[model samples]
Target chain A: MAEALNKAGSYFIGLVRVIVMRILIAEDDLDSQTLLKVILQKEGHEIVTADNGLAAWEKFQQEDIHLLITDWVMPEMSGLDLCKKIRAQKTSEAVYIIMVTAKEEKQDLITAIDAGANDYITKPYDKGELIARVRSGERMVSLEQELINKNKEIYSEKEKSEQLLLSIFPRFIVERLKQGEVVADSCPDVTVLFADINNFANIFSRKEPVELVEILGQLFSVFDRLVSAHGLEKIKTIGDTYMAVGGIRKIRRL
Target chain B: MDSNEKEKIVVSVDPDFEEIIPGFLEHRREDIKKILEALDGNDFEGIRIIGHTMKGVGGGYGFDAISDIGRFIEAAAKENRPEDIRQHTEELASYIDRVEVVYE
Candidate 1:
C-alpha cells in the first residue's frame, strides 16, 4: 500500500513539471495568490500574479501571458471584466482564461462564459482536477498562438499590397481600386492636348538661378491646370517649356 | 452577367463615391474648410496655392469631379478672376452637398 501511494505521489509531481505555460494569477488574497503561483511554477510553468484585474491587464499588455487563472472577484476590476477586455482587443493572439471562483451554480458558469472565460475552476478544488484544467488550458493557448501567427501573416500581406498599389497609381486611384472601382480602362474618344510654356529663357532671364526655379514652379502651376482641365496628358516638361499631348480616347490632336 | 462584364462595372456604382466614403468625406471636409478660410481672407495668392495642391491631389485620387472643380478654382485664382472663383466655389459647395459618405 505504501509503495503504491509513493508512486502515485511521484507521478502527480512529474505531471506538474512536464507542462509549460505562462500563467497569470489574479487574486487579491495574498496567500491564495502565492499558493497558486507556487503550484503552477512546480508544474514547469512560468507564473505572473496580480492582486487586481487592473494590474493583471497592465501585466498582460507588457508580457505574453498564455493563460489567466483569476479569482472571480477582486479590487479595481472583476475577472469577468478582464476576460472581456482581453477578448475585445482581437489583437491579443489568444489567451485561455480560467476563472477561479468559489461559486458552483450553473448561473456562475454562464456568466463566466458570457464574459469570455474559456473555463472555470471551483475553490477547494481537487489538485488533480486543477492540474487537468491547466493542461487543457495549455492546449487552448497553443491554438490561440496559431491564430495570432495567422493574423500577423495576413496583416503583413495587406501592408505589402498597399505598398504595391501606392507605387502603381496615385493614392486616390489606389483607394478607388481597393473599393473595387473599374477605373483603369481607357476613355473612348478622349482628347489629349499638350502645351509648352512661352519664352523658355525670358521668364527667368533677369532672376537669380535659385529664384528662377522657385518662380518657375509657381508660374507653371497655371499651365498644369489648363492641360488637366482639357484632359490633356502632360508628356514631359523641359525647363521653361512644358509639353502636353491631347487625344487618348478619341484621337483629337491639339 | 459574365465575369468580364461584372468586372467592367465600376466597383462603386455611385458615380461620386468610389472608395471608402467616410475616409474621403472626412478628408474633403477638412480641405474645403481650409479653402473657404483662404477665400474669405481675400487671399487670391493663398487660394491659388491651396487650389493648385487640391487639383493635383484630387485628380490623382480619381475624384475627377472634385479635381475639375479644383482646376476651375485654380484657373480663376491664377487669372485674378473673382467672379469666376465665386461661381466655382458655389459649384464646389454643391458637389460637397451631393456627396453622401456611406459608413459601411
Candidate 2:
C-alpha cells in the first residue's frame, strides 16, 4: 500500500478506491493490443503497449510497470524470452507477468512458467477472466511491493538502533553488544578526568532547546577530539559535564 | 456454402466497448483486403499475422466466429493451403458483413 502511493499510484472511485495499475501489453497484433487496452482502460487502468517482445522489454526498462500482459509468440523476441529476461534481472520489486497464449498453446504454459510468467490467460480471452487474472496480478504486485517496503523499514530501524547503541558505548562494546554479548569490562590503573562547561545553566535558560543541543554537540565534538589526541577514551557525557579515562589499554601517567 | 444467411448475426457486446466497436469492426474489414493482397503475393506470413491478430481479439469483443475464422486462416496459411486460406478469408468477409453489434 505504501509502495503503491510511492509509485504514481492507486485510485479512489466514488467513496472507495481501487489500485489502478500501470499495465504493459506486449502483443504483435494491433487488434489484440488495442482491444486489451480498451478493456483494461475501461477499468480505470493506465495502459501502454509494445508491438512485440523486444519493444516491450525496452518499455519495461524505461518505466516502472506494475503488471505486464504479453502474447506468447511474436516477431523480434518471443514472450517466453521476454519473461526470462525480466525474471533474470534483479529488480528491487516484482512486476507480475501474465502470458497470453493461443488455446492450442495451453500445453506450453509449463514452458511459460519456467520462463517466469506469474499467470496465464488464453487467447480469445473471456473479459471476466482477463480482468480477474489482471486483478490477481495486481494483488501479487502490491503484496511483493509491500514486503519490499517492510524489509526496508526493518533495515532502517535496525540502523537507528545501532546508531543509538554506538553513541552510548565504545566501539568494541557496541560490536560485542551487536553480537548478543552481555559485556563487562575491567579497567584499573587509569587516570580519570571530568570537566564541566561554565555558565551552562545560563546558556540553557537563554537559548532554545535546538540551539542548546547544537552548542553542546559542537563543544562535545571538540572535547572528543582532544581526549583522543591525549590518548584517553571518552567514558560518557552528563548534561554539560565531560568524562574520559586514560590508559584503558594499560597504565599511563596523568 | 457462403450465401445462406437471411438471419441477422447480432453480437451482444458490453456497453463499455460501445465506443471502439465501430473502429474495431472496421479494422477487421480492412483485414479482408489485406488478406486478399497477401494471398495474391503468396505473403503467407503477412496473412498469418492478420489471422493471428483476429484470432486473438475477435471473441473478446463478442465475435467468436471471427476468431475461429482467424485461427483457420492462420493455420491454413502456415501449412501453404491456399484454398483453405481463401475459404476462411471469405468466411471472415461474410461474418463481418452479416454481423450486427448491440451494446448491452
Candidate 3:
C-alpha cells in the first residue's frame, strides 16, 4: 500500500510543482516550437519538444508526461489521435492535454474536445492566455497531489499507532480497546513457567543473599534470552523463581 | 533597390526570443521558393502545407501580418486561385524585406 501510494503521489507532484514546471510541446513548425519553448523556459520550466505527432507519441510512450501541449495537424498522426491514445492507456496518472492549432472552426473545437483534449487554443494565440492555462492546470494537479500526500501521512500515522499499541498490550486486548470495550478477557492456552536455580539451598548456605542475587541475575538473563527467542511473554521474577507465559497475546506450540 | 526598400520598420518582440528571429525569417524565405515551385507543378497539397505552417507560426512571433498572408495563401490554394497565391507570396516577400525586429 505504501509503495503504490508513493508511486501515485510522485506521478502528480512530478507533473506540476510550484517552483519548477515540467512541460512537453508538440509543434511541427520550428518557429512556433522555438517561441513556445522560450516562453516556458523564461518561466523556469524544463521542456521537451517533438516536431510531429508520431514523434510526440513515441516520447510519451517512453515516459510519463502528465502535461502536454500539441498541434492539431501533423504528418503520421493528428493531435486528436494522440489524445485518444493517451486516454486509452490504463494508468493511475492524470493527463492534461492542450490542443494548439489553426483549426478555429466551431466544429474543430468540439471535435478536439470530444477526442479527449482537455483544452483548445486557436492559432495566433495570446501569450498571456497560454501561460494562464498552464498555471491553472498546474494548480489543479498541485491541489490533488497535496490531498494524496495528506492521506499518505494519515496512513503512516495509523500504522505507527498500531505498532506502538501492539508492543505494550496483547492483540485481543488491543482489539477490545479499539472497539472501546473494557479490555478484560481470558487468555487461553498460556503456559506459566516458574523456574528456580539448581542447588538452591546449598548455594544459599555457601553464599550471602546479596551474592545469591548476583547468581539469580545471571540465571534470569539466560531465561530472558529464551523468552524472546520462543516468543513468550515474561510476567515477573520473584525471589528465586522466574515466571513467564506463552499464548497470551500470540499463540505458540510449547 | 526601391526608394522604400531601406525604410526601417520596427517590430517589438520579447528580447528572450531575439536569437530565433533570424532562423524564422530564413525559413520564410525558403517557403517563398517552395511556393513558387509548388505553383509550377500545380501541387495544391504542397502549397497548402507551407501555408498552414506559416499561419501556425507567424502570429506567435508577433508577426500578425505574416499570419494574415499565410491564412490568405492557404484559403487561395484551397479555392485554386493561383493569382491570389502569387499576390500573397509577393506580400510575404515584401513583409520580410521591411520587418525590423526591435526586441523589447
Q: Write the per-residue lDDT of candidate 3 for residues A107-148, one digit (tens) a residue.
A: 999999999888898888878888888877766656655666
Per-model RMSD to reference:
37.1, 4.2, 8.5
Q: List residue ranges in candidate 2 displaced over 4 A.
A: A1-8, A11-17, A186-192, A198-211, A230-232, A245-254, B1-6
Among all candidates shown, the one with the greatest DockQ: 3
**Clash count, candidate 3:** 0
> What is the TM-score (0 to 1) of candidate 2?
0.85
Q: What is the lDDT of residue A190 in candidate 3?
A: 72
* DockQ, all candidates in order: 0.00, 0.66, 0.70
Task: Kindly indicate the candidate among 2 and 3 with the higher lDDT.
Answer: 2
iRMS, candidate 1, in Å: value is 30.2
Per-residue CA lDDT of model 2 for A180-209, tens digit only, reads 977766666778898997887985897888
Candidate 1 on A1-254: residue-level lDDT in tens?
22323311121344542224668998875545654665576677778889999999999998777889988767899999999999998665567889987555799999999999989876545446777899898877766666776988999999999987774454555677788877755556544444455675775578898997887777668877887787665555567666665655242221
How many clashes in each candidate?
15, 0, 0
Q: Which stretches of candidate 1 lie over 4 Å from their true place?
A: A1-20, A88-90, A180-254, B1-104
Q: What TM-score does candidate 3 get on C-alpha atoms?
A: 0.69
Which of 2 and 3 is ahead in TM-score? Answer: 2
